[model samples]
Target chain A: MKRNGITIGLIILLIGTAVTAAGIGAMHISPQQVIAILLKQINIHIPVTYDEGMANVLWQIRLPRVIAAILIGSGLAVAGAAMQGLFRNPMADPTLIGISFGASFFAVLTIVVLSSLPFMNGALIPKYYLLNVTTFAGACFTSFVVFRLSKTGGRSLITTLLLSGLAINALCRALTDLVTYVANDEQLRSATYWTMGSLGGVTWSSVWALLPFILVPIILLPRLAKSLNVFALGEQEAAYLGVKVKRLKAVIVVLTTLLVGASVAIAGVIGFVGLIVPHMLRSITGSDHRSLLPNCALLGATLLTMADVVSRTIIAPAELPIGIVTAVIGTPIFVVLLVKQKKQLRLMS
Target chain B: MIITAQNISYSVGQKPILHNLSFAMHPGEVTVVLGPNGAGKSTLLRILSGEQAPSSGTILLNDKSIQTFSLTQLARCRAVLSQQYMLNLPFCCEEIVMMGRYPHFNNHPAAIDRDIVQQCMQEMQVAQFTGRLYQTLSGGEQQRVQMARVLAQLREANAGDVTGKLLLLDEPTASLDCLHQQACLQKARDLAQHGYTVAVILHDLNLAAQFADKIILLKNGQLVKEGSMREVLQPDCIADAYEMEVEVWQHPDYNFPVLVPAEHKVRSILKTSNKNNIHEYNSRSFVKG
Candidate 1:
């Protein structure tokens, strides 16, 4: 009952933030006007004195960005939660596991290689969708390679997994840099903007694209909640308790890859949203993935919406990248938690 | 139902850990695997539970190859408790115990499932810690919780109907107190009496002598003795397996074997080697001494 209440509270909070975020951007529309305009879209026009330009900016510019933030935030957070549970480590995130870097490397490659290819000029395909597919494949391939590298005598060790992630992250970064040298001016700008991460330039089309990635995982991951809880007991024990260990690992690896890859393709490589949101919710939810996953989706949506509001308004006119704002906010929380953990260890010892 | 292993062996690189081990666990008996350190007791348990495959051999469950059984199918038939239990996440104690019901996740645990979790936690003396974080429990308390988890798994497997089932425990009583140790082994015996097959790896010969219907002695990855009480309780084979001289005698009150180290007993198994019956000589000499 208490768990349900907390989740409900998070959902309310996310909705409240969404409304406030949409209202506060370039044109300072009131919350009442925001709701009035939103209702007008569905043919329930409320009689209110609102400027046409205010309504247009609210609908076109801010609403898509708000929806994009919710999806990106929710996707990154749930992916982080699942990865941490699968790895049986509190600090594990998709970024730490090299999924994000692999996506970044592949995204950069698509941008550079497509620019030189003559077919890209002919517009045979929507180039953005092609980039998304390539990123997804690259992230999945990275996971496969890392899994193979860490297997010793047919058993995959989580101890070796961390070192493998570090090595792969470094290798992918170097390769991305080496390929960046071959790009022309226009392609270089696209690659640079993508690697830096943003939710700007969003449209209703991007929100449509983000839906399958976020909703599929949101629906699928919670079904594994019980299995993931069993996993907390240790892999061998989990298998003994009827969790098909191999299949569980594969599903988690692929799901997280899809989520991180899609988020990267849509909003570039946003850091710290995955790390910060899930860890904060884990303490409150007590690590049961049933409660943990849903709460992560709500709170991750709320947090990044609030962060987007801050990033766009802090310096006014010239907006900071959403990635920079998240790190600036997340680093202090991480440091404080670390110090508290150290103190607890000292007391325990 | 029967769990039968034939010519099972395991090796790490070139070093052999278990060799040509074969055994059939029977219903209505507690079969305790007794051995010293590095005797492949846990390895054998792992193989029997279908967690680890043997390097070269076959294990059959009810006349079917174990390799053919899916993990969920194998979980529906057997439950295991290993030595090490580690979880970095801070799950509550009840949640930890409830994890044993994973195989039934899709079916949605009913009231009976909730009742089993509570009952097992109470039996293991961990009911008060249900709200406490599992990581905060002491080692012994955590061991009891894990035992409850193992029991919950077995109870869930038998929820459909009680039949001959397999229970493999690796030192389940290692970190337990005297009260819990007796309680745990007694529970194993109670289940065994109800046609559940029980296998345990025990360090205490006295406990095995007290509860086990049959005992298997292992030494250096090889079976030294496998039989009923009288066949394997001989002090000679135990001394060879454990590499320490010991004396065994029937308890004066209960008539079951009572073990005392040679260094602790006077003229213990030393002057009585030539006796016609060691039990008879020991009873006379021990009582007289």
Candidate 2:
């Protein structure tokens, strides 16, 4: 019952934060105006403009960016939560499975090499398509490699995964650097910025395209919360409790890859959200995944949306990258968690 | 109900672990498996828990083949606590115990599930640790918490049918001190008395003798002897299984077997004698005796 109350409060906070974020851009719209605009678009009676400038700002620009933040945040956070559970390591992030390296490598390649191709130079391929396709492919490939390398004697070990992620990440980074060395000045700048991550370029089409990839896992993975809680007990206990260990790992890995891969494809490489959000939620929720996961998803969305709002408003007219805002906010929060955990450990001892 | 394994064989790579092993665990009995470290005690528990398949064997649980039962159905019948469980998580004691309800909680845990967890915690004397983090507890406390978790699993199974409760514990008391060890074994014995089939892998022969109704002694992955505690826990059999000289004596007050190293008395005498010659003779006698 308390959990229900918390969930309801979080929902209200998320809605309020998202609406405020949508209103605080260069347009200087009010919160009421933002709601009226949304309601009128949905066919509810409201006094709001469907004017081209306002419509473009609300629907084409701010709306997609807000939705992108929510989706990417929720996706990364859920992926992080699942990865932590899968690895049974609190420090594990979404990239522990090699998704970030994969996405960054592909994004760099598209920016440096593929975009320089004659047919892909300017006219034919949409900039978003080029970025999304390359990033998705890169993420998929690296995930496959990492997953395969971690399996030894037909079983996966947590150590193997950590080591493999390190090896694959290094390899991807090296390759990306190799591409960067030969790239033109324009390509280098774009590649560097893309690697840092941004939600500014998000469009309605990109949001729609990435929806299923993120939404399916968001819907399916939470149902496995009970199993994951059992899994956190250790592999043998999970198997003894009737969980199919290999199958569960596979499902979680594939789903994490899909969600994170699509998230990276749309929003570039947003780091730390996945790692920090879930860890924060686990402390409050008390390690029950059923509660922890949904809470992480909501909190992640809230954090990212708030981060996006800050990214837009902090510098006013000139936007900060969403990734920078997350890092700036997430680092201190992570340190606080570590210190709190240490203090709690001392108390327990 | 009886769990029967026919010619069960297990191998890791090319080396055999359990060679044509056969055993039956009957309901309402405390069955203790005694062995040295590499004698496949944990492997046998794993096989019985369905965590691993025997290389060649058919295991029957109450006339139904083990493979025929769905994973959930098998889990409903059995709960296994392995020798080593290190979770990289700082789960609270109650949450860790609640994991035992996973098989039974296809949806959210019902009122009955929570009650069983609470009852098990009370029985194992871990109720006070419910809100404490599991890793922060002492080794003995952690073992008791794990026992509570296993008891919760058994109770959950019992809720559906009292007859299907089977508890498999591997070295459940290894981390425990003498007092808690006795409590854990007594709990297992109590579960057996309630008509549940309880199989425990124990290194302490004395504890096994005190708790087990039937004891199976294993040597080199083979069943060397199986019978009632008195029949199987002879000094010779235990010495052979452990590859160490041991003296088994009947406890005057408890009517259970107690084991002491055969050389303990001799070693004590040599320490007090202050004579090198006597010490050498006693060392020789200790091995030869």
Candidate 3:
């Protein structure tokens, strides 16, 4: 009953935040105007007074960006939650473990290398698809390597895992920087803006294109919540309780790669939504993954939408990077979590 | 169910852990595996639980080769409680207990699953803290919760008969206190009486004497003896397995035998003892049991 209440509350909060965020931009649309515009588009005509261009701005600029934020935010959070459960470590996150960097690295590499190729002139293989495929590969590769390196004996040493993540993040960051060094002017501008991770680039077409990739994982990961809950019992213990451990791990890697990879491909590298959202919700929901996962999706979407709104309005004329806003808030929380659990971390070692 | 391990041998690379051991665990009997450290008791239990495959042998569960059974099939009948659990997530005890019911349900747990989890938690005496996070429990309390979880795993919805189920426990009493240790072994004994095939790996010789209907004594990864408690818990067999001298005495108020370390050697050594003689006594001076 409590889980249901939390779920319903988060859903309502998400809708409220999305509407409010949609109304927030340089050319402001009121909340009532935003609702009227949304309802009118859905064929529910309502009498309201609003500027003709205000409706255009809401539809063309703000709404897609908000929807994109919701999709990417939920995608990253669910992936992070599943990774934390899969690794049996609370500190696991896509950004922390270099998955986002890996995706960004391959994405930049594709733009720099394939953009000038001879066959790239025509749509032999769409550049968008080629970029996504390479980014997914990158995410999967880094995740597998980090996981394999961090496991000593049968247990995952938490210190080793997190340290290895740091190492991989450094390596991917260096490689991404190298790719950016050689890019053309327009490509460089896009890549640089993407690396900072803004929702500024999302269009109706791009949102539709990114939809299936992100939606597949966001929809499917929750179905594995029961198995992931069993996974918290350790790998061998989970197996003893009849979970197909190998298959579950494989599916998680693929789904999370698809999730983080697609989101990074779209939004560059948004950090900490994956980490802090799940971490906060776990305190409220107690890490059951059934309630934890759905609540993560709803709250993650709400928080990132609100963050985007703040990023837009805080500087007014020029906007801050969405990643910068998240990082500013997330860094202190991350440090606080680390400081509070210093003893627990030592005990784990 | 009768689980027969035929010519079981296990090795990690060139180092063998178990070698050419054959045994059968029967329903309605508490068979305890006893030996010193590194005797491969946990390894043997793991193999029998179908978590690990023997290097050169086959395990037959009721005349069917264990490899033929899927993981879900084996899990429905057999549950293992290993010595170390690597869980640190702050899931509540009820949620942790519900994990044992994973194999029996698809997505949502049914009423019968909840009932069984409740009953098992009550039986293991962990129901009082069902809402507490599992990570916050004491070591012994955690062990009891884990015990309840495995019990919930093998529990059938129909409640009474447990004929084909197998429960394997490795060093279950390591973190437990005196009363809980006895309570844990007593619960295994009770489950055995209810027709579950119960096998445990224990380091305590006296606890084995008190609860084990049958004993499998192992030494250097080889079985030294396998028989009833009276036949297998003798001083010589235990001393051969552990390489320590012991005196077997009949308990004054009980029918079971009690093993006491022979202090006569220590007394004599102390009587005339220099540091050199004390070292000699510990090294090789005592008579082999």
Q: Pick the candidate with the highest lDDT.
A: 3
lDDT of 2 by residue, A168-263 (tens): 878877887888889989888777666677887777887877788788999999988888888887778888788888899888877887777788
lDDT of 2 at A327: 81
Candidate 2 chain A lDDT trough over 10 residues, lowest sum: A122-131
Model 1 alpha-carbon miss at residue A209, Å = 2.9
lDDT of 1 by residue, A44-66 (tens): 98877789998889878999999
DockQ (Cα-based) per candidate? 0.72, 0.56, 0.57
TM match of model 1 to true structure: 0.93
DockQ-derived CAPRI band for the predicted complex in model 2: medium
Off by over 4 Å in 2: A46-52, A110-134, A147-164, A184-189, A336-349, B156-160, B266-289
Give the DockQ of candidate 2. 0.56
Model 3, runs deviating above 4 Å: A118-125, A343-349, B264-289
Candidate 3 global Cα RMSD: 4.7
* Residue range A164-266, candidate 3, lDDT tens digits: 9899999988887888888888778878766788887788866876788888888888898988998888787877877788999999999999989988877
The per-prediction tally of clashing pairs is 0, 0, 0
Better of 2 and 3 by lDDT: 3
lDDT of 3: 0.86
